[model samples]
Target: MAFDSLGRFGVWRGYTGFSPEEAREYEQLGYGTLWLGGSPPADLPGVESLLAATETITVATSIVNIWVAPAKEVAASFHRIEAGFPGRFLLGIGAGHPEHTGEYRKPYDALVEYLDELDAAGVPAERRAVAALGPRVLKLAADRSAGALPYFVPSAHTAKARTLMGSNALLATENKVVLTDDTNTARTVADPAIQLYLGLTNYVSNLRRFGFTDADLAIPPSDRLFDAVVAHGTPEQVVARLTEHVDAGADHVAVQVLGDDYLPALRTLAPLLAARS
Candidate 1:
């Protein structure tokens, strides 16, 4: 499976212009993949440049919102990348929040249709994944695509997702990490990122499934909830928290380092994570 090539860890970043130098650095540091988030366009605008810049690192979308990026367009983009980079790109698609999507209705059915279109468009099931947060979609991803790439979830959720996905699927969990030792600093780095998801119903519902209460789901987010969802501390301590996802069931953990810059944290954690994975 292409999942094997993903090593044991990958870097997750918001969709933006990828720096060739930064990408090369990620490869040198031993991260197997660079996951682009924030729902990239159907053309997959900056992907080729990223792939061309690095030799072996897999560049994947953390998610391309199905509602925004049509199946055929995304499928064409996938083929274009495959022709040039071959096994270097992975298509990650998802049904974005109803709160944000104007035409959001029957998301599960919509996702099935999108997958069907991708199938007709000739995108291999093995080369794509679904950004699922619930059991039904998780199973859909496992049965129909590569597997689930769930976000805003804890290690406990990883264990449950693994059960639903069975044993052979590529279960890559997205984990947020703040590379700091002090509690205040960690919260300072993580709070802004956490606040956004707290308003999104999908993430809130998922957190509740894992036993978090309404208080935990507040606008500012309770410290207990923040601690559970975001791994924060020293590099070693942060790595220990991230390892929990792998130990629970994640085949690969996509580390989303929260801060002003990602390189410093990536550099510090790379060797430590390489030793563990």
Candidate 2:
């Protein structure tokens, strides 16, 4: 079985654009899964509605924060949904940011403990995934969960992760793609989108491992910095650029189109939707 039902590619939406109607279109458009980002509240009504709306698209939490929801609540939600949606759900759980969560310490150990709780609660291992970055988390993700969904990482990091996870594990990389064609202007807008992530330890650490220096990881991101993180240009050009991650070994790529207007961007990326199997 595919480690992730993602089965090679998906779309990453900020959760605002996932209307009932648009979701139906997304499934028809051939996006195998939809990764909902942000710390959406534990209820996950959005996820349930999405799973109900689409026939094939997998509705996943890019990460459901372990601190906020707790394993018992997540397990309850999983049972409620799985009974109705079955294979349409995938859980992506992680220990989130330090400043936001407060109890931030030894994320790996915390993550493992959380997974253990989920396991004890009877949420099957195959139905869930771990949000990871760097070698240790990647290894833990492969060893304990179905796979890893790494966010804000580039092809170089994907290549490195592929080595760590080995060939059997799922490598679903979240790549930021911009539909805007303008070089300087697009990068300018994309910079802010990436700026928040720059402060994230998981993201910054991954970039460091990928060989980016402090200067490169600086705020307001330099031109080269923007280019490295955001896949900008025409649809096909961006598609070709992102393909490098797949060539390196990513089993799936969740393309997050930047600059807010996702409907048009999703249309622009329509051509590549069929690539998912």
Could you estimate the TM-score for every candidate? 0.98, 0.95
Q: Could you give candidate 1's per-residue lDDT for residues 1-277 as a string of tens digits?
A: 4787888999999889458788899999999989999989999988988888899999999899999999999999999999998898989999999999999998899999999999999999999999999999999999889999999898999999999899999899999998888999888889988999998999999999999998988878899999998998888899999999999999999999988767899999999999988
Candidate 1 residue 2 Cα shift, in angstroms, is 2.4
What C-alpha lDDT values do all the predictions have?
0.92, 0.81
- Which residue pairs in candidate 1 have backbone atoms (N, alpha carbon, C) closer than 3 angstroms, thus clashing? none
Report, for all candidates in order, the number of backbone clashes: 0, 0
In angstroms, how far off is 276's CA in candidate 2?
A: 7.5
Candidate 2 regions off by >4 Å? 1-4, 273-277
- lDDT, candidate 2, at 254: 85
